[model samples]
Target chain A: MTPALLDAPAEDRLAAAIGEMARRSSSAVAIVAQAGSAARCTIDYGWLSRAIVSLEAGIDAGRPVGIVARAARVETLVVIAAACGRQHVPVAFLAEDSRDLVGQLRDWVEVDDSLSLPAAAAGERGRREFETVPPQVIVATSGTSGPPKLVDHSWDSLLAAARLAEHWHGLGWLLAYDATRWAGIQVWVQALLTGGRLVVPASRDPDVVARALVEESVAILPATPTLLRRLLTSADRGLLCRSGLDRITLGGEAADAALLEEAQATFPQAKITQVYATTELGEVYRVADGRAGFPAAWLGKALPGCVRLAVRRDGELLVRLSRDTAEVGTGDLVQRRADRYEFTGRRSDVIVVGGAKVYPKRVEEIVRGVPGVAECRIYGLPSPVTGELVAGEIALADPLPENATPESVRAAVLAVCREHLEPHSVPRILDIVKQIATTPAGKTPRKPHS
Target chain B: MRPDVPNAIVTAIATVLRDTGRDTRPIESGMLLAGDLGLDSLDLAQTIVLLERSLGCDPFRSASTSRSVRTVADLIAIYDSAVAPGAS
Candidate 1:
């Protein structure tokens, strides 16, 4: 891995990196969007520069600008480059359907395919004027449980985890996450910083995404575990193996050992890595040992004076970003095993049954191990007698066997849960549901169970 | 009334369950499709499609009637009512 670009005290590394790449190879493909077998659109560094110059002329300096548009669009990226890179204006990327747009964004622009550069401003360009203070890049939280909040990051902080690969080229990245989000931004940043191509899918469909991966010859794929599971199950597994994927980075949700092992088995060529990160805190650390969590030795260890880890008495993982004493709570509950700290579940996702606390992820893991269960969601239901009763909604795998009945599957699931989990953790009410609802952010909804 | 409608629905569900490596023995009319059978949205959809193909009619197309189906008995009732005498 190349060293991180932290030695240089630059204001906007994004702009500086793009400027350098434009000078090096203007014809290099900067962005690619694939629909089916062929690329629908491909933008080079030269075209990107012209667009950025034109866009920069219109925006005012030293102001936060919100870009309200679909993340997959090329124009959205252009706006981000112009606002955050050239004009030194902070850019907040908001989804088109975002309802909470009025607050925090007094100056915002809505972009679409119809956006075009003015003929007069197309020729006016020099190097981007680096501001003394780097503009912040704002990303919204996934809002799985509640309304999304905007988080700000400087260019240095945003590219903290990105490996510096100045000489690397032709690296294709599949845009699996929402481009407006931190994970999505990281994908493009890493690609752009290294002069690689960013592959955008025509749609969020699993087949389309898989096709893009194969057609674009994508090397790095960063995605949430939920999306990865859906892709693995819905798309052709053989096709994925042939896609030449070198690395698979999973984040956003807890990466269980089962999923990690399954990913490893499916893509033997790729190095599967699980990243512990949050929207609030950037990437904390990454585990690539083909295991579920980081080694227990990593506890209290500091990484190059930039980050330090500590487990609180209550089991919440606290990360100190800098050498200073300031720390942030990850809101995740972890348990220290003999050799490693395993992520159990989110603190807020714990369901209390009677006086006993049960983590839904633990129950879900146990329930999913049952033979016939394809997918499941564990939650707490209101009960006057027990305060909250453990409940589960399960989806059976397709083409269930002739001998298998609903009761038999339920019994099997309950039996496994009883064996693996505590008595209180076993779901008291197990329902076979057609589907478990997911938030718009593609996260399983942990809303208070009605 | 189609005398074999209930049998056909049961047979369709049982075949689907059996093919998918699930137990089909507990598929009684009184059992809840979701709670008792562990039929998720996808399984339920596949089951309905199979039922429609076997019964030669789409009960779910009638929103007013299909909305009431919560259990195996309710599914059988819809099929019985749809294929019964004087039924539209």
Candidate 2:
């Protein structure tokens, strides 16, 4: 544990590793907590140490402490590190309802309890010093998105990822995303290792996130394709007029050409990186240029000791342990291109509309091309006439350009789909939204409208 | 198609819920899943296994169809449609 602190520079250590980051970095506001206007708060490490002490105390009790936190908060970082240090198995839950979340936890635990930072800090210091423990992380799976499946990870697994990430980029602003599930867990660990500042905006709104590139002096942004498209244009323009960000990384969902181009246009100064990781396998690939499609080239050779990637006969991605023999078959459908591979969609995401096979991305790509549409998600529904029908959920850019009604947007989307797809591939039910509800990582919820 | 097929599934699902000591009503096509029954994401996985074992139908393989089966009726419709040809 002492070497963990000695091995890293002060800037790269966790709040628990360094004695006074919260106090010394008073001017460098580390986190901004925002809900509405007045409820917003910002803090440096000075006040944060108190919160960490509370987390440390809870972990000392040998109780499994679970944290349900807002994204990009320093308190979130401290609690995680404290849980890790105190040997307390830390479980994080990010879902829609607290009540429902409690219900889900019922099977796992008999007693329900919550620890608030403000309350925990009320007591004075005790003799209990936090101890290092074996790490376990529980991440919810998409199949269980309505409720999440807990995936566990070890300290070695998480640290290996950090070392690999540090090998790629030295230090800069880490644009962290709360990709719906456990993906966000990596963001915190990466920041702790790199000793770089974490940048989040006043809101998850793409516009605010874009502006923050200039306002916060951002450098590295890791996100899903859904969010990359939204912030790219604004960040690019903001960068041109002022200081710019450096890197944009996409994962969680596949990014199409249009989406990648949009991100490049937004942050022209940033390098575009793609990630191939899952809850099962920490991080399989680090596509620095978003080229190479297969994990074999990216993970097998490049990060040889880190991960092993294989493609099954049906084009499904498989991961074998880099150091061991555990093999994991991923459900994502992929295509190999010369030296690189690309994600097609989820095996479970395919829909048979009418008699033809329809992929949600195929229709989603076409629908995204329509003017005035901000974001869209496509799924299949059982149709009496066609066996399955393409259905879509859409969010419009505010003040839907001149004459852009939901009908017109649907018409434009349909016309594009019709031109490129069979009639069966066209969406039959199109629901409009003020904004698409997305998980922190930037993935559209499987049942977006629901 | 026999009218009893859908009824049998509806009755079985209700019984499963009841066996868990959950007070449930007779199954209707319109009953919302998450809202009407406390069956959540975990419950759905549990229900799917239970339904497969009880109904003795081929394990539902299609994701597109799984996405469409939102309600008890939707599940019943899928099960009923599959049983129709065999029941004849």
Who wins the TM-score comparison?
Answer: 1
**Local error of candidate 2 at B76, Å?**
24
TM-score result, candidate 2: 0.67
Error of 2 at A17 (Å): 2.9
Residue runs of model 2 more than 4 Å from their true location after superposition: A1-15, A20-28, A35-41, A54-77, A87-135, A138-146, A163-176, A179-181, A233-243, A291-303, A306-308, A323-326, A336-340, A397-406, B1-88
Give, for candidate 2 chain A, the lowest lDDT window spanning 10 residues: A106-115
Give residue A217's lDDT in candidate 2 (0 to 100): 62
Q: What tens-digit string does per-residue lDDT give for candidate 2 at A59-80?
A: 5453444443433354564455
Give the C-alpha lDDT of model 1. 0.70
Q: In candidate 2, how many Å is residue B45 off?
A: 28
Error of 1 at A66 (Å): 6.6
- What's the C-alpha lDDT at position A49 in model 1? 65
